[model samples]
Target: MPVIGVLPYFKDIHIEEEDSVALAQRVVFPRPGAFNIAVLALPHLSNFTDFSWIERMGSLHVYYTDDPAQLAGAQLIILPGSKNTIDDLLYIRGRSLDRVVVDAARAGIPVVGICGGYQMMGLTVADPYGVEGAVRTVDGLGILPVHTVLEKEKTTVVRRFRFGATDGPACAGYEIHMGRTEAVGGERPLNYVGEGFDGYRAGAGCWGTYMHGILDNRAVVEELLAAAGAPGLEIKWFDYKKFREEQYDRLADHIRSHVNMEGIYRNLRLQKR
Candidate 1:
């Protein structure tokens, strides 16, 4: 039997219940915005909160949905990291969403994959040691001409790297996974870590990488948006580090400075934006 996480409830909206809580925790509707982007919320989807900053972006509305119809209108599609790549890949095939994604890719919608999602975008994933559960080999989505071999050894590291070329934007992120992938087709390299290349990119607006938080950087986000056909998107640069500092300061103010009761009252009295 598959395990499921508890469905979250927000405000006064009641979520539709389903047989399994995992699949039931469905669609994350679009926020007030212009661009409509969709992300595949794979079963055992991990590090999804990495997109929190993206969700807060004013011009970008992210939809975390499994329905193929909802995906039809997306400018860009994202395949997020999964805890169990093979099983989640099977889950996607079971739901018949693999065809939807492939069709979308064929129709020119930009698609990107991260970590295990990166693995799934390849040609084949061979798990001879059962590192991610059952010992098996399976064909991937074949979006990228790459092959992955799952192993017992896992790679976990944090580093700052550039997008392969000297003129490419600088990016920082971490890697955590149990497979090593190699490019088999004529796909362009995605990024340069320290001494070697570490991702695959194609002219078809498809990208795959093992790095997490690659989208957190402003440059990468802008580049991806431009490729997705929203060339003139005006995305406000959000300093995530600065925002964290401000939040920490606010928390300290509440704890050390007598709760700032009058300040809260003054804010409440101000007109809404």
Candidate 2:
């Protein structure tokens, strides 16, 4: 079993100032965890909210870390979406996490990547059209037998897909990426989207998918956590839309019953005194 430790929420690193103004804010940590997951917070990470719901789950402790050493205790490692695949792949190599992630997967720790992270898990990524940066080919993590060729036209769509070769439920997610991945060495796919395959699963603990909200489905998440050795953790079947709707209704009721618009107006009038 991997060593699970409760660490600080996020590192206190200096974020460069942009035209947008900001101030220091509190970073909320997850509850007491049964499973520890480390997410690679790349420089241009996007669509990170895909994991926000899972972070709120009681059974899992998800933290974003850039240090390769932090991969030691993580039972599952997630390579999150990035705006720039080539640059982020280089960043992972620079941090020496490429080998670390590969070794972790080989050791039976489940590894998952979303979007650009999926691109990095392939055998090779060729950006011939310079969709991201320079027109170059970079070696991927090689966990999966797929190769990606970035195209000028981006694919953005929302669809429901059945899990490929697994007993998992049908998952619905959106795809927003600029590359098309093709399996070259007959690797099993992760899911089937429309008439085509969408992802690849390598070995017992490696998975790469273009789907963004793959983990949002209850059945999929449960199966993954169980494979990562965090079985029997309570699966809180949450309806996120219903939760938001109830919150909105509760806020409206509170305002209609307890808020004092007249008293506020009178108070504002008397504030001159």
Candidate 3:
């Protein structure tokens, strides 16, 4: 309890930067949406920000919930990345959201999963090495024909990949997970990382992948929207990578604006004299 008193500031403050063209994150927003997306709120959800880019694209409303009734009207249902796959999987089952996901898949609703969520889209996930806390296996949602095994060494790397063919325009993403998922059969790969596969697609609107940030690419987002049967909804394109870099530049500018570097240097020089 004493540690809290000794630590740094833990409250709200303004964050600004260069010329203010770079926007600050505001808690309140005027949400005018046309698409309803339900992201499963797993107990240990890690990369929920993976879908933040979509919120920038106008007309999409993404919210997280665990209730089955709340998922009923969603055009797209996403299972975001989790830190503890086994624990979160058990959490999903305990809430009976597993049945909801399975039923949604059968009903042909667009269902997507990333990283730990991707592993849960398969038939089985075995933690033989106890990398996920227990040396056991659990049944998955059965949406895709894949099997996952959690090994000791975790996979953490950035990847450039393309959907369908190797010659397509490459999109950027990063993988950070302990499981290695393999195709059991029937499911077509969603993308190619180098000459190898990275994700699986069983049918229309059903796919799973270990890659994060894949949605940042306009082409990939378009395909995903189309798969979700939103062809009428047109996507406004922007380079998310470029946008991210601008954010960093603005952050630097913000720091410079607040800190008097020249004054500090003069004070240090006088002290030495």
CA lDDT of every candidate: 0.78, 0.76, 0.76
Measured with C-alpha atoms, the lDDT of residue 13 in candidate 2 is 28
- Tell me the tens digit of each residue's lDDT in model 3 across 158-234: 98898656776688889988988888755478888886888898765889998888777777777668888888886
Give the local distance difference test score of model 3. 0.76
Structure candidate 3, residue pairs in collision: none
Candidate 1 worst ten-residue window by lDDT: 11-20
Q: Tell me the tens digit of each residue's lDDT in model 2 across 97-180.
A: 888999988888999899899999989999998778864899999888889999999899997888755444688898999998
* Tens-digit lDDT string for candidate 1 (8-62): 3334322222323444554466444559888887767887645757766778887
Residues forming the 10-long window of minimal summed lDDT in candidate 2: 19-28
Clashes of 2: 0
